[model samples]
Target: MRIIDAHHHFWKYTAEEFGWIDDSMSAIRRDFLPADLKSAMDAAGVDGVISVEARSILGETGFLLEHARQNPWVYGVVGKAPLSQGKSAVEEYLAKTLPGADKLVGVRDVLQGSPIEVFSDATFNDGLSALAPHNLVFDLCIYHNQMQATIELVDRHPEQRFVLDHIGKPNIKDNVLEPWATQFRSLAERDNVFCKLSGMVTEADPTNWTAEQLQPYFDTALDAFGPKRLMFGSDWPVCLVGVEYPDWLSTVKTLADGLSESEQADFYGNTVLKAYRIDAD
Candidate 1:
């Protein structure tokens, strides 16, 4: 199928750096580098990966860029930089960091914990403006409640390309839909925006989630974005918190079973390539 995993993570974990990996996440508290991921990708028939940043730190971006440099299987990277510093600082950081590393295709901020209004800030919008000139995409990693603000932010910058990480991070754990579905439909109305069919496993009843449990959210995304704008992402290592790579792959595939072969191709790889502008070898 020529699968391209649109989202996953690689990290040389340390307690000081990855304090977010608390006691319950011990399974993923250790290091997970390209070597570990390559085996999983191979097992799942994934041809390439766009490694997304797990930490909101400049060093994490450098780490992924170096990994991409060393690993042929890593097709691209979604990096992290402090967008609160506004446009010039972001430009300077990109100038310093992205010169030799061509695999850095996008930038992200872990907006899940932030207030919704943060997306509307002038400084943040200025930082977002710096991306288009560099040909970098932005990965929006906000919770579902922030969709209105996300929509506003995306509306303000039609020139910038964005992929909404985790399908707006719907509240699957509680089976809540309403406002999320409505907000998602609103966000999908933006032509420049794309959505990832990833991160759902962890958001569900992680220990006992059924494909049926995830189907509604998947259906919502598919309906809103259609096959062309929806891409598959494993959200690996972190996905280990809920399901293994093969199982998650199977679940997503099953949900997408109704799609035509070409539509399946778009979900599996083409959408990722088009959205991120990934140059796979």
Candidate 2:
């Protein structure tokens, strides 16, 4: 499929860090480096990927960016430097992060928690505005209920290109899709925004999800973002909580099987190339 898996994550934790992994989510209890991900994505037929930020605080983004430099197949990164850190700090970091242009593709925040008002933080706005001249994209990882604030954030910064992580995180576990659907549909109308077709397996009943169970959410997102803007992401290490790389890739293929070759191209490869501004030699 010549795929570009746009949203995967990596982390290095000795003990103190991954403590957040709670023994409850056992699969991601250790360090997952670029080498491990490359092997997995290769087996799944995904040619490229962008390493996303893990919860290692702002310092981790720089760490990942340096790592991406050595792992060319990683393609790029959506590292975090909370836009709320104010503009000048962001400007200086941007200046220091020069050669990073090839790898630093976007920014993200932990929005699943403080839904509607997270972006309202003046610091966040300042952090967001820092990307203005850099032309880097913003990846919003919000919860289902917080989707509206995402849309509002987009409204305020029409210049920024926002990609909604995991279809605004629809709640498939509870089978609640209405208000989520309503709000998601409204936000999708923002042409500046896009969506990733990943994380559904984790969102579904982990033990019992068939293709039919995931169809509506995928269809809704495709219908909303259209083929041109939607991209495929693995959400990797986080996805290990429910499905492995191969399992999730098979699920995505099953869902995409019904589409035409062109549609497949858009979802699996084209959109990523466009959105991440990937340039591979």
Candidate 3:
């Protein structure tokens, strides 16, 4: 399979810049750059990676774009924009940064921490509208509770391409499936929206999470989005908090063992290529 790890990150770790890397995440407190990721991708037979922004800053996007320029294996970037800056500012930033448009495939905000109502804000919606004209995707990085807002956002901007990062970030650690599964299914009804099969491990009981533990959530996504709309992503350095790269890849592979060769292709790589407009070459 032509494997594309659709959601990993590359960062020069500094506590002040990435305050999310608290003492609990001490294992990933060090720097993680292209060289470090390339080694892991090579070992796991991953062909390339779509670098997602870890920090919700424009500088982080610039860093990924520079990394993409330097590293061929960094296939594309889902970078951050100042969404709170309102529409005109976002449009200006996109015009400036997207001149290198081939590598800058999408934009994201760390919505997991923001108020759900942010999705409904006039400024945010206006900023989102700007992306459709540029043919850029938006990566929705929200928690499960925010799905209603996400659904409303996706519905309002039917022309915009949105990918739900982390499958709406289910609370697998608590084994709470109710509202998440239902809301996820509702969100999947929007044809313009896609979902990433990423970030599950950290949502689970990190240290002792089994493949079996992840299967239900995986199955829910598969059933809801089907292989064509669902793409695989490692959620990398964050994934390392719960499971190693190879093991996580293996677990996804095993869960997908029953898929046909073509279905496997979509999950492993093809879906991202289409969704992000990644230049596979």
Clashes of 3: 0
TM-score of 1: 0.97
How accurate locally, in lDDT, is each candidate? 0.90, 0.81, 0.89
Best by lDDT: 1
TM-score (all chains, Cα) for each model = 0.97, 0.94, 0.98
Query: Which residue pairs show collisions in model 3?
Result: none
Task: Indicate whether candidate 2 or candidate 3 has the larger lDDT.
Answer: 3
Each candidate's root-mean-square deviation in Å? 1.0, 1.7, 1.0
lDDT of 3 by residue, 1-281 (tens): 79998899988888888898877779999999988999888888899999998877788888898999999888899998777778899888987888755799999988887887788898888877888888889999999988888888889888899999999999999888989999999999988888999999888877878888889999999999999999999999898988889888999999888899999999899999999887686
User: Which pairs in model 2 have colliding backbones?
Assistant: 83-127, 84-123, 84-124
Give the distance in Å from residue 175's predicted Cα in candidate 2 to where it truly belongs.
1.5
* Candidate 1: residue 76 lDDT (0-100): 94
lDDT of 2 by residue, 1-281 (tens): 57888888888766676665777577788788888998898788888887888773778788888888788787888877646678888888777774535688888776777746567777778778888678788888888878777777889888888888888888888777888888998998888788898888778876677778888888888888887888888889888887889888888888777778998888888888787677764
What lDDT score goes with residue 217 in model 3?
94
